[model samples]
Target chain A: MRYTRLSRKKRSIFGSVQLWLGDDHLLVVRSMRFTEEYRRFHLRDIQAITATEQPQLIWMEVALFAISALAFLMMLEVEAIAARIFFGVVGAALASTAVYDLVRGQRCRCRLLTEVSSEVLDPITRVSDFDRLTTQLEPAIAAVQGVLTVDAASMPVFAQPAPGTPPLRQEDRVETPAGKYIPLLLYFAILANAIAYAAGLLGRFNEGFGAAASFWFTEVILCVLLAFQPRRFGLKGPMLGFFYVTAALIAIDGIVTIALIVDLMQRIAEAGRSGTKTPTIWNIEWMMTAGKIAIAGRSLLGVVGLLALWLGRDRVVPASEEVPPSQPQP
Target chain B: MTGDLRCDSCQGGIPPELWNQQQGALCPYCGKRSWTRVFPAIQHTVAGQSPEAIGSESESSCFFHPRSRAIVACDSCGRFICGLCDLDTGSTGGHICPTCFTSPKAPGSGTLLDKRRVLYDSILLGLNLGGFFFFFWPSLITAPLSIVLAIWYWRKPRSIVPRYTTFRFVLVIVLGLLQTAIWIALFWSVANSPGRGSRGPAL
Candidate 1:
């Protein structure tokens, strides 16, 4: 077997990429190191070649987030109205930053490794672009690799099933069952909170109530999406996003929980001074106990779901990699 | 920005349909053409090349396949192997034969060749935590063992991923003394008791 250098005229050293075309494999060597490490991607082992453009993470956004987190520490005393308002603004800023990430975070990631592990070649940043390099190399890969992707959009029919028949094939149903959807329990808990939120809306619907209702409604929608669309949750960047978003939402829920506790304690103190039990639902000890139990259960479910998401982050393999054995290599 | 295409000018997220243009993607937000390169997916044939069989009777034959030509000898066991049987785990070439590589307990097996140092500190911390629950009795053996291990492996190598070790070492020592004190207290109470002589009445 002979090795030849791939056409390097069009290729630029934008993001530390050096590729060589071999007889039966692709020799990829990452740059910016004294001792070069070359990973040989065999044509037979390569399932698919996929690329994604993501924005580079900045230190400024991280610093801003740290400031937002520190704002929460200023509110030890409930009487500090100024500190409370400052915290509210910081929380809003952090939420806005999450939205900011969804927009501008795009760096080009080229996955040249096999299916088992993500042995990435190089991630191209703005300072270094690999568009022309990939354009030159794609043809070389296709010449040896063969066709890898099946575009669903190009196919007309997905096979509409007859009445009372199972539509999905057994192997195609590798998507986890409802029991494996740990986030569903969290979604149910959020829905319960949203229902109570809507019920409580009728008595007093002020500007603050409107804001709280909207936040809870947003949380309910996010949880529902996370619960039902388990397959989409496995997508690389979005999976990590789901984890962080869930954490942020849980933190907000905790702040609301603390406020409720403070209100309950105030009601109890008022009743003690009067030497009689308050008749209102808000002051009822049994109702308070039930609320505490529900909050504890919801928080417990959220923590469990977060742990599961972290542990099972790399569990889902790409669908393209699951090629059938019938089409054996010649 | 292939997955979540966005207009750099306005910093607004652009939908896939709006950005799917050959000439250049025109961002609807800022009305600027976001000219970027995008590549389609590639697939390959999953086949391996087979080694040639030996024809000459005088040539050295493979250990596994007697008819095949022997290309290299195993680094660990010195067994002759054909081109396909030479599994090189190391880059600098001491091409190990498949027999030594696949053998579970063999010295050259890939399992024992770890580059990153394992975290024994965490394991020691776990033992101390468990001993605390069992009320310092298990700590008598575990505390000293952990302390000894920590000091012994201190100069061996640090973790590939860095972590604090000073706190762990201090905690292990503190618990070791605490465990020793509990054992001493039990002995002191028995010796100072008024009915110490009749403590073992049944015996």
Candidate 2:
């Protein structure tokens, strides 16, 4: 059957709607008003759609997780000093990525709306088919859009709901503004940890301890809360919640490594002051042991979650095939 | 589908090849309909450095007319500032463009140092040449006033005119310190030396 691609500029009493007909010719109407549009589409109209890949965002996220994983691995190595250096590098990388992602994500989404499409459409129609579409198509669409666009008065389309409509419900899968801050906070924590670790390496032992604690309490704590809340509080679906939580756990592991390095530095400083062969004030072995345990626990959990997501990717609902009547039914 | 494709809104003809390029096609005229049988070539535009490259240049237009270009450069930031951006400095030839000059340079700027050095030298000259007169009552007040003026101006911000130089900073610190040292030496010498007048009981 032949499918037709249609795009209509819709303006209601409330706001504008940008519609996209996918390759499958499935109509995906993104209303500026709600997380989910009230209008439904007949699946037969869609042929297929090219997906947007958010590689910049995803790669950035993955890179951070990888660095955290590398830091954890370093802790397991025989050379304690080398492990500390690795941990510091990892902390710095994580923090940098977090900050970049947070700022970039906002800017990207903003730009995407203004520069690319005011609204996006996927060909899949049924809710059960979303998994296939998100995995196969959403990333492609994100890639095409590149960074989010911004104008003087407003951000990109998808960043917020349409004007004159009630706010998105908590149950909808859309990201809340508060959720955007999670990555930024994570990045800050990483930055703090990096500074502290550097100080330890430089032999400024006192400053290092202060830096580590500050990062742990501020960045790590916030990340942990962001990670746990979406699932613990049932704020969002398991897919998105998993991404946030896993990313947070990985970031926390990076922070813990920095703390352990601080402990080691303190011990070394004490040894120098006492002119002793072995330090009595602090135990390097115990600190290393604690770090290993944290890394192992977080990484294991993250790996499991990632695998589960990959496996369950096929079950998501696809966009529906039925097109709604042009006029509202009386 | 085999015939010439036309945009529904504008009735403009679409290239036949575009219909076969991808799964969906975009209309060239109204840009509304997507052709399901064909995709179009993705056109990319390279951005170049244009008049918009400098944002501030656009904002600071001519004061008299909003549309005119700002012809003058602000001594600060080297930005093109309009007539409205100009500010007057109190000194002779002290007209400072507002965009460049704000408050006086910090103590570290060379210009502030030069002014300070000049003030310091004037104080030393007054104190040394007029110290003998100060032995009498009237000259002492002028001497004290000169000293107070030197100190007061020394702490103030530098002038907008005659932009500050680095050498002036070093010169001021050195000259101020040397003058103070000399004044102390003179005071000590006169105070501690054997008294010409015997106010005390005869030894």
Candidate 3:
């Protein structure tokens, strides 16, 4: 059967998502490193398609700019020319990415709902692209399912229950919003890392590495929690992406921290044997490539995590408000 | 499904006023702008129904459920089935009974439920390149293994997405052979070295 590409493929580090219009179905294909997974929704079965503007992209832009500013500050403090160049390059790259994202327009999350499944169309990130998709798919879908002309304002089909439908139980009505404690966990971990970094730069070896160890421990726990609880916690969209990135950054940081610790131990042992003063951690860190990278990664993660926490903050409604208690406050 | 379209960010129900609005509306809970397009299928309620009882002996009954009237015949097994048992596979694949569709040995069951495709070409490429990038010693082990796998899966069904060439497989095979040859030559040279060859007498 012939297929027409519906949207341009959106790629990430791990995989890419694309949409294709098939003979009787719309196919969403997710291509990973070595395999391709498919989900197909028949034209007649689609109930609704939604596109919501995501403010996380704006937060991401702000975070990147903040990181660039932090890098500029670091560049001013560093004495080595190599360190200055590294900071300058990192700052430029992040600033350019932020500017590019700003110019590309707002991002959106598009989801397709059928009777059985609700699937995200990740490739259609831009609002304009979603509009195009709606225009193209509507006619084809209407041809199959026919146009529905209910007084949507008065008779929202989903708002009222069908005949013989059972009411939801109060016990089953409880909801655990996504990222309930995850952002806070990330916040504390980032704070610990920042303290550790500052302490390390000040030559307080024990205090610095101890804080680093705590950050590593927190990250390891987070990795395990994220693996099992992503869906259970109702995590979705950009917040989900943020947690994944945090997990990855921590893994890299773990390796770099271990290397730095090993190097520090050797330097301390050498100082003891030679009857000389112990070398400061900063003195050794500035001299190593892995140390520099660890420091930079820490700063980037800090900025991003702080912004994500701010954006994803939950609001508590007053008791006088008539809104349904089941509604998520995010 | 008896609710409005949910906010993409927070999963709260969107009011009907937000549906198909050109400017979009801010969600009451999350304040995110949601653009929703409702379709006829949303109103297509699926109420559960018990199978019709056989009123006359002339009417055929379901093969599995004898008391219930048969609505359609299973495409694969040709057995008369009730509406509940008939699983439609859209326009291409006809309706099938649950037994035939889920049966591993059924003739046409494989393609009907195929949700994923393992791209052996990409796997072979990764194996070949991973070994080379990490170290040459690993190539000694992975090279022969990849060569065997490449040949074994060479004729296996590839991705349904379609590709024009087998260039990746060819490249993998060539690289595997080259790595194997290099390892063999290195081992041969090491064994035949003058110092190593004369080591027995010196010991």
TM, chain A, every candidate: 0.33, 0.32, 0.41
lDDT of candidate 3 at residue B53, scale 0 to 100: 84
For model 3, give the RMSD to the true fold: 14.3
Candidate 1 runs further than 4 Å off: A1-77, A80-112, A115-330, B1-49, B90-94, B109-119, B133-141, B148-203
The number of the candidate with the highest TM-score is 3
Interface RMSDs of all predictions?
A: 15.0, 26.1, 6.9
Give the per-residue Cα lDDT of candidate 2 at A324: 19
| Candidate 3 C-alpha lDDT tens digits along B93-162 | 5778789877745666545345787889999889988997796678988899889999998998676655
Q: Write the per-residue lDDT of candidate 2 for residues A1-330, one digit (tens) a residue.
A: 222223333456654444332332233343332122322222221112322212135455555655554454444342678767877677666756654444322211100111122223432222212233334433333444332222212211111212232322222222223234344434444554555544543454654555454455445444545555533222356656655665666566667666766866787787889988755323456754554454355345545644554454332212231111111111
**Chain B TM, cand. 3:** 0.73
Across B47-67, the per-residue lDDT of candidate 2 in tens digits comes to 321222224654666443455
Off by over 4 Å in 2: A1-235, A239-259, A278-285, A318-330, B1-203
**Worst ten in a row by lDDT for model 2 chain A:** A106-115
Which pairs clash in model 1? Answer: A14-A128, A53-A107, A54-A105, A54-A106, A54-A107, A55-A105, A55-A106, A55-A107, A145-B43, A145-B44
Docking quality of model 2: it rates as incorrect
lDDT of 3 by residue, A68-141 (tens): 65675566557899998998788768867755554445578899987767888889887778888888788889
lDDT per model vs. reference:
0.49, 0.40, 0.70
Q: What DockQ, on C-alphas, does every prediction get?
A: 0.02, 0.01, 0.23
